[model samples]
Target: MDHDVVLAVDIGGTKISAGLVGADGQVHRQSEVATPATRPLLEEAMRGLLTSVADGASPRAIGLASAGPVDPPRGRVSPVNITAWRDFPLLDLVGAIMPGVPSVLVGDGIAAALGEHWLGAGRGVEAMLGIVVSTGVGGGLVLNGEAYAGPSGNAGHIGHVVADPAGPLCSCGATGCVEAYASGPSMVRWAQSQGWTGPDARALSADAARGDAVALAAFDRGAQALARGIAATAALCDLDRVVIGGGVSAAGEVLFAPLRKHLDGFLTLGYVRRLTVVPFELGRSAGLLGAARSALPTAQFESPTPA
Candidate 1:
């Protein structure tokens, strides 16, 4: 018999990916396309992708994972990178594509965290934070083995956590946000300001790996800011682990080494000090799988630890 699956879609600034996923987090079919610059084209692409991936198979449900800022309850999204979509009716599109199928909408950050909690590095952890550090930093929470999307579906926005009172301005019009320092663009911009000319975060990461002083320093600064953000989130939530991903995270030890060093200094409390940080295991697949998990009618991640 064919495996029962949900239609899972992950919509991002650059790409729109769709997959048919089973309850066990296995993807049976998948496809992706570049996100169009216009809303009409985007809608058309999404419709075609969904239809192709589904292949006439009626999904048990639908899971839509969208980049924030998202209104999950209302199935609307306004991703900063995707300027064409402001308060876009994403779920309505899903509904129109597959009428009568139950659907769940979640922020991409939340989906990443839920994916990690369900099957990735956070599998056994009771409370954890999953963060994405790229052109922008985003985060989501899994508390007591349950995804906590909060009232606005923006609960674990750790990127906005303040790291310094006198730091650079963030895209969110705030000063000293972790994103102002740790995001890929922020790191590259800071490196450039210091006379370290690199094309992008990828180049910076390469140079940092080669022991270039300026590149290393950039990573160090970004790492410190990320450490502060992680520590703050851990303290506030009493977290057990943190899973980091996105483009900047691929810097590996260039980022992780400094982050670990700085995190130790910030996490002084005994409980908080025990917080462990790890790389995201599922990578890009996390969002799709997490969305599928959300669509599961009775899905719940029961913690091995006692409540």
Candidate 2:
């Protein structure tokens, strides 16, 4: 139980991924599989995923990052998208699968921030926020070189933050939340309401790239809301940098161009205006490495010694 390596797991609505990681920030023998709908199926898939990745290498500790809202105190999870796992005791399940090793759990947003800060886009920043702009908007704070999850492990959940009072309603039963404007579906929904025929965010991005006025306008609007949220976070956190990732962010300049412009308009204070926004450098590996790093301190490698 004295190895530098740890078991890292990233569980989401659509997929489950597992890997073995070390302090060097490398994830090896990673394996991924579609997430099943039922809890039993999920456990079965997870076991397979872990077994495939672990091979004969037993990690000392386990770090798990899952879609939330999660209760770290009780080691439970209730992800919105994963219906069968309401208040599921994730820690216990992981412990059962990989016994005799300590495990740590955190929201994926926080894990992403830690990952980006340790080795990705937020590297070397004193205070930062990692934003995932996908189906939903998620925010994670990395303040003073460490993650700040706050009480209830929900400090940086910025999706519900009011960015526009007159904006659309959010899934969290709030109006004008940033997620209602900048989330991929939200942007596409707005575009469709305006006669843009694209079915998803990807098509919208393509249309915007080709100079489709309505599509471009959709991105512009989404960027405008995202800018408001980012500026608000920067103002409050006095952040040195912000890193954006996820599917919608992959739209590249289609998203960042207007985002920068709108962000400039919202940034008032000089100190906050200095915050630099960038895309995540680690891509999909961010959460994995983040979980690995977070679990490293407690990692207790034993048994199944690398054969």
Candidate 3:
């Protein structure tokens, strides 16, 4: 059967979203559900989700965007939040569901970066980084008009980059990682430790918006850590722009103002100093769009096109 669209799936710790996307990157039909807890349930959920969007039309290819760490060369994934899966053969499972269609997988950060570069905030930029700052800090890169996932598909993991050797311990067992300070939970934890009694990142943002001193201080600290990571990345990759998104990024100036301020101080190199940081325009749909883009034959990095 000749196919007119691609099946794009974005799998995160909290939710799984699937959609039928055309070559133009428009999502025709989409649906999502909360992530299942166990491997069996998760598999079942994915099958059902894909089946729903692919009801009648034949998909040219299946593209998956999953939370890291992932092995794209092996078509496997083991996201930190989804403890039920470890080296899960996600590509094989998608192949099983749709027999002959080609399927490709990429890290969520890579997908977001590629998607932003294609049609969002970083469009037309020569080199850029896309960042997600929610539960954890995540990043990906687009260089010279191409998405670079590296050989291991873990190239742009800026969150794991050390920001302060003496800072807090990270979930990955690293000390003072960008994630340790800039993640939503990290910022909240710092505020709480400082006697700012916020229940969550949302509350912390609200407090900061109201000019609460401790909450503001918490964001400042997180911003400084994030700035350190961003500066390093920009310097190393010669990035021209950065697009930041995710739940915490919605805090508006509560995050960007301090981030830009700290970034300005950290970026002393002339080439890296001109890097423009902007908010993502695609909101939560960047991953889905990027997955779809990856499936397209014209994508800079893609598998063999099906006939």
Give the winner by TM-score. Answer: 3
Report the C-alpha lDDT of model 3 over 1-307, residue by residue, as the tens digit: 2266888998987789999887777788999999999999999999999988899978888889998889989999988668898999999999888888888898888988988888899888989999988877778899898999999998898889999999899987889999999888999999888998769999999999999999999999999999999999999999999999888999989999999999989999999988999999998988888888888873332334443
What digit string (tens of lDDT, one per residue) describes model 2 on residues 1-307? 2255788998876567788886678766688898899989998998888777776776778889887778998999987657899999999987888888789998888888899998899888889998877767777899888899888886788777899888788876789999899988899999999998879999999999999999999999999988998898888889999899877889999999999999888999999988899999988778778788778767544434231
- Where is model 2 poorest over a 10-residue stretch in terms of lDDT? 298-307
Where model 3 places Cα greater than 4 Å from the true spot, the runs are 298-307
**Model 2 spans with C-alpha error above 4 angstroms:** 1-3, 37-40, 301-307
Model 1 scores worst on lDDT over the 10 consecutive residues at: 298-307
Which ranges of candidate 1 are over 4 A from the true structure? 1-3, 298-307
How does candidate 2 fare on TM-score? 0.91
Model 2 per-residue lDDT at 179: 86
Better of 1 and 3 by lDDT: 3
